[model samples]
Target: MILEKKVPELWTHLLMVAFAAVCVYVFLPSLLIIYKIIVTVILIVILSIDLVLIIRKKVNYLKLTRLALVNLSILLIIVCLIFYTTNFLVLTDANSLKSVLGGSTLMGKLLFLLICFLQPIVLPLPEAVTIPAGSAVLGSFNAAYLGYSGTISGIATMFLLARIGG
Candidate 1:
């Protein structure tokens, strides 16, 4: 006699829905802010709901860890892709951008850093290129320090905004 665990059809449907959500997310590009937010929220809600349902039905530590790792890996890869594409775009016009950044003066570098800090939040532009561009013009040490600090500040501001409700 062979013993097999039976699973409900709804389980298959849920798995398919999760796979489709992942596929759609992989294909979705950063376009409109509103659309992106809406789609992301929907995907997140669906995934969370499914994860909870699955976890409640069967709690496996190893499987949960694997799922977490997979999700982190996907997030990391998408972030890298965004940065890679933006960095290449900035690299091609390095000289012109360097010139436009107004040389290696302290004020100019600060301004560049400021713009980079704001680009990710205030402007529609991606922050990925700004740090690289800064590195090309303002030196690596300066770019890294300023870029990270500025990014931190911008992120902090966003957190405050989210907490305070506009």
Candidate 2:
């Protein structure tokens, strides 16, 4: 009986991960309409299955509900930030993005560091964006140092969160 319950919950968890990957990898980066339609279809199917499972009470609905809420909230926040930031800053290119990072200002360095740190764990900003920008503004060695530092710390924070939550 316990195993029966656990298997469905495990399937649900796997489905959620797949849904998130499609959203992050397929839908978020691309602007093509075809990709958007595909992502929408994939997401709809995944959500439908999860909803059916919850409706049938085959898995723990409460946990799945909380997970969905949190995931949606984070994705919404990231999307809003992307649109708002792009409009406000008018970042037309990678060079423009680097300029916004302030080149060598202390606040800019801190902000860059913060972005790098938050990016791996929370923000969906690609490492390609962060690392190359940092290298351009802060020099190759310094950028590499900061990038590694932030990445390591971010991974450590993920481990800490999982340990505490689990």
Candidate 3:
């Protein structure tokens, strides 16, 4: 009975490690496209599994799903607000896109990137808008760098929060 109780925990840890290794390996330039597809598939599979488990009542899946739904709803609302605000600012401001992009200067760009990085961790914002906006405004390389930085930072923040809460 004790062994059975521990098995699930062990399996979860192993799966997490495996996924992390896969992500690390996928970071190589040669694997970029494949990595994207793999990641998407993996996410879908994980979500499907969670939904199945919730339906089966095999775990506290219902509570987890509820939490996830709440978070997603909050994220959507924040994203909408940000989109509207950004559009309004751009429309009201006399500066054109070219001027804003050209005149933002390095510091402005860095500040924008920092906000994008911090949003996921500090706010309930959906990253869809911020990430694409970053790519559009900052270009591909900087967009990737900032996105990765934000992701890592957000993960770290979540880890710390969980630890503290626990």
Best by lDDT: 2
- Per-residue lDDT tens digits for candidate 3, residues 1-166, read 4345545643553355345444434433344577556645554555566557645656555345445434544544565567566654562222333244445768646755665566666644456655566667778788778778867887888788889998
lDDT, model 2, position 6: 61
Worst 10 residues of 2 by lDDT: 88-97
The TM-score of predicted model 2 comes to: 0.45
Q: Is candidate 2 or candidate 3 better by lDDT?
A: 2
Q: Which of the numbered candidates is closest to the native, going by highest TM-score?
A: 2
Winner of 2 and 3 under TM-score:
2
| Candidate 1 Cα errors over 4 Å, as ranges | 1-96
- The alpha-carbon lDDT assigned to residue 69 of candidate 3 equals 38
Measured with C-alpha atoms, the lDDT of residue 53 in candidate 2 is 65
lDDT of 1 by residue, 1-166 (tens): 0111213333543554465455445544444568556645655665565466555765333344346435644764586578567754653354655776755488867787676677557755455656677787788898888888888888888788888995
For each candidate, give its TM-score against the true structure: 0.40, 0.45, 0.36
Residue 95, candidate 2: alpha-carbon lDDT: 73
Candidate 2 Cα deviation (angstroms), residue 43: 40
Q: Per-residue lDDT for 61 in model 3?
A: 51
Candidate 2 lDDT, 1-166, residue by residue in tens: 6446666665666666565655556546645678556646656665676667656765555475547645754774587569567664544355766887765567767867777788778776778877888788887887888888888898889889999988
Which segments of model 2 are wrong by more than 4 Å?
A: 1-93
